[model samples]
Target: MSQQEHQAHSLKQHWRDIFQQGLQHSQSRYHAEDFEIEMAFYGDLITHYQSQRALALAEVQKKLPQPLVKLWQRANLANYYTRSAATTQIPLLPIYRPQQKASLKHQLWWRSLRFKDEIYKDLMIRLNRHPQLHLKVLQHFLTESYLYLCNDHFMQAVHQRLQQRFAHSSEPAIVVAHSLGTVIAYNFLRANPQFAVQRLITLASPLPYQAMKKSFKQRVARPTSLLGDWYNFCADEDFFATQPLDRAPFNFQPQIINQTIHTFVDKPHEIIGYLQHPQVIRAITLE
Candidate 1:
């Protein structure tokens, strides 16, 4: 396999192993069946994004000169670093707490498994040292956001998928959107007000972020199509969900119910972590 392919494969396997180990260690909270389902979903998402990233990079390389492409990439890297530095004011909460009598090796293992705020700081330091990995991560985020927000073809495909899923059904739908999916769901519901929506649940959403809100290029408001309440769940450690949709711009007649809950320490931003939260489960299943 090519170097890029090999790297992708290794990264995928690494995450799968981490997730499996986490599940095995927390068997009381999660089941074996949950592990299989989450792994399948995670694998599909990774594959789709990797293909999209390759296509985007290839298109850019074809159109732009190599020198300009490199300059653009450097600019993006610099911008990411600046933003990360500015955001350091937000304190990172501690995730690991060991028994006083635990052995040093056991404590170290727990620290690795449950990444604390110090771990995040260490990761940022390492990313700064490794420019390639830093650029790769920045490109991944930028590529996906650009495709969904700026590329007409990509947006149309997403809209088509939503139409195929909901166009024929007359019953009210309950949308449980996570991270970037929350943005897509909101946009879809706003455009297609004909579809009846019972409840809109957004988990780990970035809607409250100024950059994300500005991308809409309009004032934010609740979707008229929504017949019921909007419930938004956020984790304290989820970087994407920096704030809840409770303040200005998001506030409306029927206020959004914003609840903060704890997720798995190893994967705070994962959908599986958000889905397994007691409050989130109750919000989705409760009548």
Candidate 2:
């Protein structure tokens, strides 16, 4: 079907296709120019750290005596920071957090930070255990997914380009976004308050409660003529979509729907794999 079509059955198919298409395009466009250079710089930096770490570890192992060597091993080679939130009484994590269940996948990531002695424990483990592998994860997942969607300039370019596509017609749209696309789609809707969004469907979204609220604080400034329902779908194991934005901060909190999905350990947070679910399919064609 064409972009103009808004049929129930076709809409679901379009949403499914969009999720898969977005991932494919984003992967290639990731290396698009100056931004590509910046990504490359970070990748190289991780590489340099990895090489240096291996050499330094080898040297320390050869020279240090038994007990002293173990102590030195505690020192991080790459010094990569853990992205997980620290479980402290800090102002950042927020005492009034969304009631998102903890993930077993993130048990170590969460435990090392929260309800524990040191968040540094998990950070060090990641840095020390496998610098090369962690670097790859950061390159492919963190920077590629997170930064690509969050960076202001890139989003502006996308926002402008997509605005025409999103709200060009008088008919409403059911935006079914997946993974990083969720962040992009939300911001697009928020930015163009005039756009008539019939319904929003976010799958495997990373848009957390606090951050999303802060980002779209003035979403009601323009007062869109017709803004409708929002349905969010998330898998228990997918840590990215762990928290639902069903709270006060959001001008319109989404109706979050949870489910159990058997995901690949490496790519547990992906949406294309979960598109076959009936609930997810139904969400795209809502009324």
Can you write out model 2's per-residue Cα lDDT over 1-287, one digit (the tens) per residue?
Answer: 11112333444443435334433332332211211000001222223334433434444344434543343235321122121111111121111236677789776775443333233334424333554433333333244332343345444555565665644456776666666567667666766667776767677765653333323435433125327667767665454455555544443533344445433332334443445344554554441
- TM for every model, in the order presented, reads 0.59, 0.47
By summed lDDT, the worst window of 10 consecutive residues in model 2 runs over: 32-41
User: Candidate 2: misplaced stretches above 4 Å?
Assistant: 1-141, 145-150, 209-226, 251-266
Candidate 2 accuracy as TM-score: 0.47
lDDT of 1 by residue, 1-287 (tens): 01122244453353344334434443335433442211111223334645756756655455544554575455343233123222212222232223367689877976674555344435444544554444444454455554555555566666676787686566787777777678778887887878898889998886765445424634577888999989999886554456788888888879999999877544466554665455665565552
Clashing residue pairs in candidate 1 (N, C-alpha, C atoms within 3 angstroms): none
Q: Give the TM-score of candidate 1.
A: 0.59
The pairs that clash in candidate 2 are none
